[model samples]
Structures are given as C-alpha cells and as structure tokens.
Target: MANTIYFDEAGYTGNHLMDPDQRFFAYGSVVTSDEEAKEFVESLIRRYNIQNGELKGGKLVSHHKGRKAIDEILREFHGRLLVTVSDKKYTLACKLFEYIFEPSISDINSLFYGVGFHRFIANILYMEFMARGAGAEQIFDEFQDLMRRPDDGKLGALFSASKHPDNSPVITQIREFAQYRAADIKEEVESLAESSVGKWVLDVTNSSLHSLLAHWGTKYDVITAICDNSKPLQESGEFFKIMVGNEQRLKGGFAGNEHPMTFNLSGPLEFRDSKTCHGIQLADAVAGAAVHVLGGGTDDHAKRWRELLPEMSILNILPDKDELDLRLGTARRNVVLLNELHARAKNGQDLIEGMPLLIARLTHRLNLPPIPRPVG
Candidate 1:
C-alpha cells in the first residue's frame, strides 16, 4: 500500500523558449491518499456545477473569478505541493550558450548563482573594455544581463571601488582566470546545454521531488509517481530513482542538516490525463500558482493561492538578478571551481583540449561519475 503522487506539467514547450506561444515551463505534483484525491476532485466538480473534462491552469486562471476559486480549492487540499518552474528566457539563454554556462547545475541556488557569475564577469569584461575606451554598447547588448548581484560580498569587493585604479588587482585576477582555459570550462558549459530542455527537466525535477521526499524522511515505504501524459523525458525516471534510491550527487545540495532519507518505490511510474484525474488537476493548480508567484506576481486571483496552500515547496528555477542570492558563499563551490579551472588553462582552446582529463580528475575528486564524452 504505497502512497501515490499525481504529477503534471502546467506549461511546457518541447522546443526552445523562443516560441511565441509558450511563455513559462513548469512541472509539479501532489502527493496524497487515493481517497483524498478522489474526494478533492468530486468537491471541485460539485462546486463548478457541471461535468468537465480536465482542470487546466491556463483555463482555471482565465475566468473573471476563476483564479480565486482555483486557489481556494488548492488551499483546502490535503496533500503536499511541489513545483519546479523555469524562466523560458533564462532557460533559453543557458541552452543557446551552453558553452559559457553549465546548465546541468544540481540545484536552484547553483543555477542562478552560476548564471549570475557569468553575467557578472561579462560586466567586468565590458567595463575593462570601456576603461580602454573600446566598450561598444552593441557588444554589451550581446549579453542582456551583465550586472553583478550587488549583495554578493565577493563581487562587491571587486566592483565596489571599480572607479579607483587601485582596485585593479581583483579585476586582474578575473582577467587572468578569463585568459586561462581552466579545464575547458566554456566548452564544457556550452556542451552542457546540448539537449536544452533535457538538462532543465533533470535538474528541476531532481531538486523539487527530492526536496519533497526529503521533507517526509522515510515516512512512506513506497512512492508512485504519475506524470501528465506527454512526450516522456529521459531524465525524469533516472533522476527520480537517484533521489529515491539515494545518490551522492545530492550531497552537493542536500548537505548541512537538510538531508532527506532515501525514498523507496513499489513499481513502475504511471501517466494520466488531467481531465480524467482530478488529483493531477490539484497538482497543476499548485504548480501553476507557484510559478505565477515567483514571477513577482501579486495581483493574480491566486495570489493567496500561492500562499495559503499546503506544504508549499516552490523551486523558482528562474530568478532575476534581484532574486539571486546576494552572498558570495551562495555559489562558492562553482566560483572556486571556475577559478581553479581558469587558473589552470591559458585560454579557451587549452581548456577545451584538456577537458577530458580535467573533468575526469574533478569528478573523481567529487567521487562522482564523469559525464560521458560523445561517441563516434
């Protein structure tokens, strides 16, 4: 008698974010008893006063007062809500330039921090060029986000006295790191974005689901997950297994007292249409609301839906510079790693050439398996 989780995707674009129609990408789930799930759906049907096919977030939020009704139902839900949201713009940026950013970041903090660091560096570079009176607005335009997070102490030290020539030491260090190939970082990062959405699915699911499971900590003997029917994601299954079965990769994020016990499962995963299953609709509401709230939304009908809902675990995978962690320790590991790699290689080519050996060594150091190189 294992508990089941009804999973669903609110909005998804299999293609890159450039698609004009699809704006946000979200995947989420509701874990509860079958009885509770059934009751929830029945309650909704009775309240709506009509037979319906499925509950869709896009439609649920559309009516004049539909948003309020949706949130109220969600607030009364009897299970935990977990949602992973992505910013199409950010996802696309990382996807298109995988070489510069490692899209395979394990958690939300790292993803935002890593991307933040890259932008911060770009700003420093542009500033350096401008200092030499060679800065071109168009060149900076190539990277939309070039501002450093003002709160991060480390970057603060570097950019604080940027007006004074004496602060050139910190800037020189970045230039040096930029000059070195540093373990083929740019190439590795770029390649990390190869299957754009694939990387995103794996990382977001791993964090959101793992966080949910960990919160309970061995309370349930088995967890059955049912995702909304659609094109299957390769990582969805494996990454779920890692969190449930216990994998060392989570240590990078699960450390420091927030560790969760490994979750066990009973059988294979399932898929169902939301209209047919009311539980999944509940999951969709939670997921959709989480995304809207994280987007700096305050006026939506579900604003309270974003708040009063059950155990809310919202992973806002897309955060603006303001939403980014202000502390340097936020991404200390990636920062140090990037610095190390940059210090080792003299330029991008050297780093790229030495990548195989460097990644092998780094993964070995972390006791993790290396990402496979492409085969012929």
Candidate 2:
C-alpha cells in the first residue's frame, strides 16, 4: 500500500525571519497508512487521557505532564517520522547570498553549484552577519524590504552596507563582489520582484515540505502526502508534481556515482484539517518537539526531550556540532563548509584569499577535477 505522509510546521512567521520571538522554524512528518494513523492518535488520547478533541503540540510541550505525553509519542509512535529545521536568521542570510552571489550564466552556474559554491558562500555571509550582532539588523531589514518590493533606494542602502569598512574578510569579499559583480544582483532582484518565487524562497514551511517530499520520494515507490491546509501546498499542485517527479534536475555529482531516482506521487497533494486528521496531529507533535529542542529550552522537561531526539528516526536539516568544528580537514567535513566558515566568521579572517583552497577541498569531496581559478 502507498504510504500516506502527514505534514505540519512550527515557528512559521512567513518571510519575516527577523522576528526575535521565534528564531527557528521546523517542519515535521508522520508516514503511515490511514488506519495506522487514526489508531495512533486514538492510542495517544487513550494513553494520555487527552480530553480535547484534537492534540496541539504547542500546548502539549509547555508543561511537565504535557511534555511527558509528547515524549511518549516520540518514543512509541508506530509510524516513521521526519523533520527539517532552519535558523530563521541564517535562512535570510541564505536568501541574501543567493541573490548577491549566484551566477546568472547557466553554464558557469552549473559548475559552481555542482561544487556547492553557492551554499559555501551563503554560510560565509551568515557567519559574518552573525558576528556583527546588533549591527546586522539594519542589513537584514533592508534586504527584507528589498525582497518584499524591489526599489532602488533599498537596493542602494544594502549595497552601501556591503561597502562599510569592516576588518572581516567576508565583508571585504562582499565589497569586492558588490562593486564588480553587483549589476547581476540588481537585475536578479528586479526580476524576482515581478514574480512570487522570491517570497516563497524564505517560506521554510514550503521549502521544507519540498525537501521532505524529495527525500520521501527516494525511499517510497508511491506516496500520498497529506498536508495541513497550507496555502502554498494547496496551490502548488503542479509545483509539487515537478519537485516529486524529478522534473527539477539533481545537483550534479561525479559521473557514474550519480544515482538518479524519481518519486511516485500517487496523486495530487491532499490538504486536511488537523482536527479531523490524526496523522497531522502526530506531525504537529513532531515539529513542535523539534523547535523546542532547537530553540535552547533549558528546563528539565525540555532537556529530557532533547535526549530523546537523537534516538528518533528523523531527518534533521539543522547544522550540528560536527558542522561547527573549526578544522577544515576534520574527518566530518562535508559540502556545507559550515565549520571553516564559522571559524573564519568568529575570528574575522578572510575567506576570499582562501578561494583556491576552498575550491580544491570542495572538489576533493566530490572527487571532481580541479576547479580553475578566475583570471584577473
């Protein structure tokens, strides 16, 4: 039987990621049959003696006994669980880097993206802004405004922020890129303003669901995704099809090592109310638990939940401790380069000067040919 996957999210403040209240966003899923899903909810209610007609993960994780109930669900649930989490500030930084650094030329972009250059640069931008502390808000706000409505004034302010004299290498790199390569950024921003794609880029809920669907597609032959009534998923019938069916090309990998696959979506995505769907309720619990843990909740109840998460079968998108290690050649190093960039961001070191080294290491990770340096 085709698995029916239920989806829900927590800490979704739309594209306004600068909100201080919720610094993280999470999307969660529970995969199982219709009958298994219904029984799972019933069992939770019967076990916890839930009086409410529906389960709310937010309310459940706020108290001692409530948290225990959620813990039990995480441990004892029968269905498979998956979740993706993002730091809202970091996500905004990613959007900024994509706008500013992504190449416009298709052929060059393929090679850069193939080597994971875009992600590497985005991480650098994120770390640099993070090191700036309170000063980062203006840049973030200006970029946020620009994303909402493209304007020359907002664009100029953002570019000017990049030009600010900072000893940080990332900042210096930004200045160079903006002055020499900024025309492309301006053109791309203006182009995106004419479409809805720009706004959707920061929608963690939308992006997470798309990622989750792609991951699920790899494992299951056929899937019926049952999502909470999210406007994006509801209207994204064709978009979901493309994402799931592998219409979007995979990021290029080493030839012969590429393992291409496609998702078998049984039909159109089904949106339903949480009140009536036990599966969605379970998904809500999973997402809520993930956000609480990522948000650095300090109480014993929160701590207990944290200990349980590593044991659960979940796909976490958040960067972990290994990704923060300062060593470039750490055995744990991967495509993300989070470790190196973070160390540089903290010490205000220069990544621009290390471009050749970065390219070499990244290419090594993919076992690809040497990436040529740009000619002056």
lDDT of candidate 1 vs native?
0.49
Query: Which prediction has the highest TM-score against the true structure?
Result: 2
lDDT of 2 by residue, 287-331 (tens): 888888888888787887677666553334443333334464332
TM-score of each: 0.58, 0.76
- Mark the regions of model 2 whose C-alpha exceeds 4 Å error after superposition: 46-52, 104-106, 114-116, 133-135, 151-153, 161-169, 243-261, 299-301, 307-376
Could you report the Cα RMSD, in angstroms, for every candidate shown?
11.1, 6.6
lDDT of 1 by residue, 1-376 (tens): 6678777776665543434455567777777766887786676656764336456666666564446656665667535666667765555444323333332222222433322444444344434434642322222222222111112222212222223344354344543442243233344433434544434532234444555555443456567766666554434555455544432222123223234535665544566777777777877876676556554566756566556533455434453443223354323333444555455544333333444454445556555433333211
Q: Quote the positional error of residue 41 for candidate 2 in Å.
A: 2.1
Candidate 1: list runs displaced more than 4 Å: 19-21, 92-219, 234-251, 254-262, 295-300, 306-311, 320-376
TM-score of 2: 0.76
